[model samples]
Target: MKILLVEDEIEMKDSILQYLEMEKYLVEYASDFNLAMQKIHLYEYDCILIDIMIPHGTGLDLIQEIKKIRPKTGIIIISAKNSLDDKIDGLNLGADDYLPKPFYLPELNARIKALMRRNNYEGTSSIVFNEIEIIPEERKVLIHNTLVNLTTKEYDLLEYFLVNKDRVIQKNALVEHLWGDNADQFDNFDFIYNHVKNLRKKLLELQCNDYIKSIYGIGYSFKTIL
Candidate 1:
């Protein structure tokens, strides 16, 4: 999943970034409030971790803006301030969870996973669609009771497609979702097409139906028959 981390402390930010990356999450960070605002406006994230004491403005204000712009996105407050008032204000401002500083990384990860499950999977532990089953926590995909080996990007692509099944997804949206800020480095979406092709091939090899359909000039759709 994609995450935005808004933190000012260099050590804390680096540690969180490293840990989250190790856990296979696409993460982008902003060390100040203004940069955070810029990223929030320009890109989308599955979840955002914000520090209450930030430069130029407060994370509480950021939460309000995020709720107004992307109400469905998950928000978590991570701050050194452990005051009850701060927590209450953040929660009232639509923050989904709060993590006080000096917290364990594993616990933070667990909170993130729980928040994601609640927001995207309706609090379910696994995602099931027909013969395909995905356990997000274990990063495992099983097809017809057999494990399907997939590269990291391939797995992410499949999950994205499954999550938004039956809707047309633009190539640009795929790039942005997968690559985030680095998406600008690519001049074309040929790489995306290749990834999709490979994913289809893998699924077809397992005797799965071709749920993905190209939309001519637009993009692709993952369709399921009613």
Candidate 2:
């Protein structure tokens, strides 16, 4: 999942970013409120960990912006304030959860997972679609109860397709998501096509009808309906 950490403290932001990266999550850091807004406007994140005390603007304003920008985005307020009104206001502003400063990184991870479950997962860790099954917590996938051998990128692509089944995913978005911001620096998107070919071959080998559609000028989409 993609995450944005909006914190003014450089040290804390670096530590949290390192930890989340170690956990295999895509993380972007914004040390101040302006940078935070810029990142938020540019990309969509599964969650935003906003520090209430930020330079230029308060994190509360971010919550309101997220409501308009990415309404499905999960939010967690991490503030040093330990007052009832602070928590209440954040909650009222639509924060899924609030964590105070000086909390353990593991606890923060747990909270992110919990909020993901509440919002995205709908209380489940595994995603079920036709014959494909994905256990997000374990980063595991199965096709008709048979495990498909996949490289890390292949697996990520499949999971992403499953999440947005029947939606046309752009080629550039896949490149950036898998290869980070420097994807355009590469020669081409042939590697993405190769992975898609392999995934399609494997699914067909298993007789799974769900397949990705090439949108000619666009990219690919996971088709569910006939």
Candidate 3:
């Protein structure tokens, strides 16, 4: 899943980014409110972790703007302010959940998973697309009751496709979802092609039909319904 962390504290932000990345989430960050605003307006995230205290504006205000832009995106208020009123106000403003400061990364990850399950995956721990079964919590994939070994990137790529099944996902968007906001650091999308090829080969070896479709110069689509 894609996550945007809006935090001003350098150490906390870095720690969250590192932990989430290791957990196979595409994470991006904005240290200040202005940067946060720019990012929220530009891209959509599966979940957003916002710190109420930041430069320029209160993270509380950003929640409303984010809701207006992407109502389906999950919101979590992660702030040092643990006052009852603050929590109440945040939830009242349509935030999905709240995490206080000095929290463990694993707990935060758990929260994100819960939120994604609630909002995107219909509160399920597993995603089943035809004969393919994916248990996100366990990071396991099985086809025809047989496990299919996939590299980390390959698994993430497949998850992305399943989440956005049947939609034409642009190459750059796919890169961004996998590599986070810094995908521009790469000059080309050849890495994506290679990963897709490997994933297809692995699935085909398991007697799975080809579900990924190339969209000419645009990108590819996961034709799950076919």
Candidate 4:
């Protein structure tokens, strides 16, 4: 899932980013309020982690903006301040959950997963499309009851396709989801072609239907298997 972390503390931001990346989450960060707003306006995220004590503006304001732009996006407030009013106000403003500072990374991850399951995954732990099944919590993929071994990127690609089944996904969107803000560092999307080709080969080898389709001059679409 794509995550936007709005935090100012250097150490705390680094810690959270590292941990989430290791957990195979596509994470991006904004150190201050302006950068956070820029990112919020530019992209959509599955979940957003907002630190209440940010520079330039309050995290609550950012949450409000996010709600206005993407109403269904999951939101979590991570603040050092344990003020009751703050938590209440944030929750009242469409925030899904609140986490106080100095918490474990695993707990934060758990909350993200819980929020995603509730909001994005339709409250289900697994996503199934015909014979293909994905357990996001376990980061496992199964085809016809057989486990499919995949690299982290491959798994993420498949998950993206399954999540947006029957929709055409632009190459730029795929790059941004996988690489976050750093997607511009690459010259071309050739790497994406490689990943898609390999993923297709593996699934076809398993006798799975071809759900990933290229749109000629455009991007690709993930169709439902008949």
| C-alpha lDDT score of every prediction, in listed order | 0.93, 0.84, 0.89, 0.91
Tens-digit lDDT track of model 2 for 36-145: 88878877778899998899998988888888878888999999977899889888988999999899999999999889878766688888888888787777778899
Point out where model 4 deviates above 4 Å.
Answer: none
The C-alpha RMSD of each candidate to the native structure, in angstroms, is: 1.0, 2.0, 1.6, 1.4
* Counted clashes in each candidate structure: 0, 0, 0, 0
- lDDT per residue for candidate 3 within 1-226, as digits (tens), equals 8899999999998899899989878888998989999998877788999999989998889998898988888999999999999899889988999999889889999999999888767899998878898988888899998999999889988988998999999999888877777787999886788899999999999999899998988899999766
Best by lDDT: 1
Q: What is the TM-score of each candidate against the true structure?
A: 0.97, 0.90, 0.93, 0.94
Candidate 2 collision pairs: none
lDDT per residue as tens, model 1, 1-226: 9999999999999999999999999999999889999999988899999999999999999999999999988999999999999999999999999999989999999999999899888899999999999999999989897899999989999898888999999998889989989998998887888899998999989988899998887788999973
Query: Which of 3 and 4 is ahead in lDDT?
Result: 4
Which candidate, 1 or 4, has the higher lDDT? 1
Distance from true location, Cα of 13 in model 3, Å:
2.0
Worst 10 residues of 1 by lDDT: 217-226
Candidate 4 TM-score, true structure as reference: 0.94
For model 3, the run of ten residues with the poorest summed lDDT: 175-184
